[model samples]
Target: MAYTKHIPKKRILCRELQFVLVLLLGWLAPHSLCAQRVSIGLYDTCSIQLLRVCPLSAGYKLLLNGKFVEVEKGTELNFSSRGRMLICERAGNEYEPCEHIALVHTDPNAQFELSLLRPQAETRTYDGNLSLFVDFGRIMCLNLVDQEAYIAGVALAEVGAKAKPELYKAQALLIRTYLMGNRAKHLEEGFNLCDQVHCQAYKGSASKYPYIRQATQQTAGMVVVDAEGNLITSVFHANCGGQTASARDVWMTETPYLQSVKDPYCRRSRGANWKKTVSLNDWKRFLQSKGVSTERINNTGYLYRSETREGMYELPGGIAVPFRDLREYFNLKSAWFNVAVDGGEVLLSGRGYGHGIGMCQEGAIRMAEEGKTAAEIINFYFRGARIVKQQ
Candidate 1:
């Protein structure tokens, strides 16, 4: 079937067929081919079965004028679909239909596990403080008095630090309910109500029932920054295993994240999947890896650090260490360990997961039951931090 074998010498059979189908569909409903969110790993879980695809370059499937159609590789498309879109990945698939590719794979056992769940991954928090720091909607506006503002900031810190991602998201939505004309930027927009707690209310409930509706409403997003005033990529947490990290502790550098400890709301749980363990290796092994004077490992704990590429630190035995890599490594959950000795058998160790940070989920949830407000819980873990406002 050499119907179209001239152009794009690399077109596969599937893509070739797809192009023809889309052309026919376009003739009927010309306006459906305009938007395509390009090359995202698209998966449809709405029905938990069917998968529709718009490869951005290869193929496009659409239902135009009551007819199913597809546009093939290297060809333009025009069509529409009545079905709703579900999820698209931020990353593009390098290989079409890779080994792990699937329409939608449901996990039978998706129950939430505290030790396995990273709080940062939950995306929301509640510090028992008044204001919530919602991360959805790309619009966050809160205008409160000094005291309330302080409370809000403290609440954000405490909860953001201590709560998991889901909890943080829920808490942020809850706080938006009590907000008024919003922040100075938002104040520019006209509001139905003026200042004074008229718009916001103080709801009291553990289920967070009343406030949930308003808090979950869309809002602005917040950017995290480093000490250099450069935006710090966020490294969220629910618990730090009773100890949150100094920027130096995780990044091995002076980052603005180091100052994150100040947020009273930011604290980790006591139990962590990942724990720090002592590693005392002999000079023979350590120096051989360092490629430097063996005496350095014998005298002091100084390891060979790379001078060219910044943040690359070496241990006494010359194991390469990168700050960013360590940050990810130290906060892993359930990872495999393979130690390869020159002549000895490979030693394998399987360890629990997560970065050992504040308010371990299991520990915090337990504390929450013990009548600990988000503030009390955060303070207990993140030492010396005070709950304060953003101002």
Candidate 2:
């Protein structure tokens, strides 16, 4: 999978980074924003999706009917479910739910196998304990792991495994901030976060990347906070073209820390420039569908975008439309693009990727290559944001 192109549109980005915390006793609690254990939703319906579970360490055990059964390294347990009961088949015999099957790891540093057995599946390995159960008549895999381990997995999954140590450290801090800020998002769902793009794309484990693991460990329990000591929304993207956009420009609600900034580090990076073309008439029709009247407007000039607004394109009758909306409608890379009239088609020359908010991954990589520290890279992108350790 292309990790750099994991930028979902602005709406999705907003949902991922939104923070709603109250200044009450709940906020002061230790487990409110900082917890060592994270329950990651690995699979929603394990029966439909092929799954294989194995033991990577010597002391791994399967909890069945309140009994701890040692799971061998070579034993492969195939999972299946019916109604509310979960079944585990090994060799040929089928074992019933026994309420729930909990894979326990005795050693904290030892890893285990939580492999996806389907065709073309990324066979991911994981550390920590796993509990397999039937939720809403579907088999669900929940991973109970350490916070730092989860951050390492997320950093490698979002930014790839080969990033520099500084870049990895930067990503690890942002992901830690995001995790703490959105820790209770799925409280009612029996997990802290899901292993999907909607919850920051955690692909099971971090055993494959030692550098990312080290970075997460080095920044353990550290999170970015605003001037008021409140946890800030931690949003990042693949590349920000030449400049980053403000939260108000993308999500309509202004976050003071997410203000627009001039970014030169990612201008020449990968996924920086792109062009998309559509017939002029078709483009005009699309605008007309958005309640715009293009009959009297000149059809030979670049689209008029608002100076105050970052990605709003101004049309005739003073009608303004967000580039985000257009990008979604036309499947474009980003909302930051320039519209021009060609002989037969309207060409959209675009820059950057994702919502162009928070830290730019490509820029962070370049900054790391230039010997900038993780804290420096983070402070450069998020205005007035400081890294702090959770108490």
Candidate 3:
């Protein structure tokens, strides 16, 4: 993984010095160095055919097939794809066929609103320029946005606007760390990342919450690094059910900083506990499918319990079933659960909401509410990790 690269301290200091000199010489903007621009694919999971773009900033220029067309602010323009060609139209204007189209804003603080018309999705406002092209029988929409703006959007989407500024700052650092590690995830697709949970759920600019942007800016060019001075995998979940899972148990990969930790902060928060029931026969059949003997199909054989997060569910005759496999097969919320055989039905009492690995969002929120700093919250969850400025 890119996060595991061990950069030498001498080289890092040299780069920081060079960056400072560049900033002093007026060769680079302050925000340009810390919060670089990134290209993100919008609505990547949806097959978009038609889109409506409205500029929210001044000095907007429309580029149609490499030619610049003057466009005023707040002008609504519609674009659609037809047989591998891009079609554009203004209100009450004829549809013009073009190979590609881009909406560029000369203003540094550019913003735009995009509405997915063909799919009839919700309209979202973004802080960036917009580019459109036809690809694979649909219109590919890309947003050229600042990294800090993108991080703010992701922080709001992931943790919501009601969280403390400390939580937002902690989340921003993790989001930025993940971005730095996985920037080339979709390089072949012509974008740095997609606006989805597969990369990070980005609903657009975080304009509503000024504090979100402030927190993101405060943590600009900062990321969590392990003892070896390499970026750490900053994974997080909704909750940890009072105990976070280790990376070795969840992903079968040993990570020194991602070990299991006791987290009591989120126990009373939402997504902490859940329950589900299934037929005893179904449970037995699932175990049988996993190669458990028929003799071990008794009522006691199907019973299991997990006081703490365990990697496997031990059955009779020394047979074991991975909790992750059970969670996937039964669609359970998390792998931390207790299995009890009640008559012909099996009740699964589960805890947590996600994979139960890494930092817990609700736990962090509670910590932040308790006046914990962003660094304290991060270090609490990710043990032995240091928050440092990116070189």
Candidate 4:
């Protein structure tokens, strides 16, 4: 009785304090619940070999079409398409046509590593769980990862890892916007997006770059949208010479947000200037192939650039050719180029690295270096577009 004298009956917890504690705990919960995992098609080929796939966390389970398959950590797997089926070396298995293998683990935040063994001499590491399957008689690997994590990787891959913090942030926003704008682009192909430039050029995880992660985290769920709250196209390119192109100029589609603008910042950046010399006869022949009359064109005369149009060139004999076509035919670096005759060759002096439509990446980098934030850069490049956070 004496030992328990000082122990008062446990005081009833205050309801206000209990409510406050619950609210604080709710606020402190991880923000990852708001993030989405993107299913990206990777290595679209007939066959692929993963050199070594090891779960970074314990309790990883492999399943094929909801059926568990026996596999251990650090197992090498080869996947080949066999008449719409995937052939795997694990468990001496011959999967049915179009079978999908799912990788899961006990930990909700578990991640795994996939190492490519063939076709690419260099080894690239990829994060997130791997889903191997065959689609339309081809082997496809889908990487299911957090959307913000995907943006970090795509930004570093499309640009580089050594960009300024502000530039990285800008790129992160652009990437995120692009993904949201085209989230269902490849639904027919069984994945949300492709790993190539056709979608967003996502090579692998950018976890090594702290700045990329920071940029992506800071701009989480942010997307460029028009005034009506629709996601903007969010296009970008390597450089734009001195003037960015309008969507109407490049792709013949007039979009309100993709208006042309002068950009002096990219003129001094990398990929600003390029030179390619093709034989004047070859040039004429190529134009003639496009139904243009090259009879009046000579090897030593000036080829007139379009006066009204931004990237169109007026050839002799009334042939108006878009530089986009020429760029593709001659493998030129960009559409912002001028043609001149020099030593029996057509000297194509180009002043950009890409289509010059949408955000000029070099210009944006320069702006970021000069203390422009992601919102400022987005506003400067994308007319009538505003940054909006998705729910």
Q: If scored against the real structure, what TM-score would every candidate get? A: 0.30, 0.87, 0.90, 0.82
- Top lDDT prediction, candidate number: 3
19 Cα displacement, candidate 4 (Å)? 43
Q: Which stretches of candidate 4 lie over 4 Å from their true place?
A: 1-34, 45-51, 69-98, 106-109, 298-301, 304-309, 316-318
lDDT of 3 at 173: 90
Consecutive 10-residue window with the lowest summed lDDT within model 4? 1-10
Q: Cα lDDT of model 3 overall? A: 0.82
How much does candidate 3 score in TM-score? 0.90
Q: lDDT score of model 1?
A: 0.28
**Alpha carbon lDDT of residue 71, candidate 2?**
80
Candidate 2 ranges with C-alpha deviation above 4 Å: 1-35, 43-47, 118-120, 301-309
- Model 3 / residue 282 / CA error / Å: 2.5
Per-residue lDDT of 308 in model 4: 26
Q: What's every prediction's RMSD, in angstroms? A: 18.7, 6.2, 7.6, 15.4
lDDT for each residue of candidate 2 in 1-391, tens digit (9 for 90 to 100): 1222332222121221112111101222436554466777775323344578877777788777668888887688887776666778888888756546778775655677767765326667887888766555455677877778888899888888778899989888888888877766665555566776667788867877777898778998788899999888888888888788898877799898999888889889878888899788877788788888878778664464332226678776678777877877788888888888867688888888877888888989899999999999999999999899876
lDDT-superior candidate, 1 or 2: 2
The whole-model lDDT of each prediction reads 0.28, 0.74, 0.82, 0.69
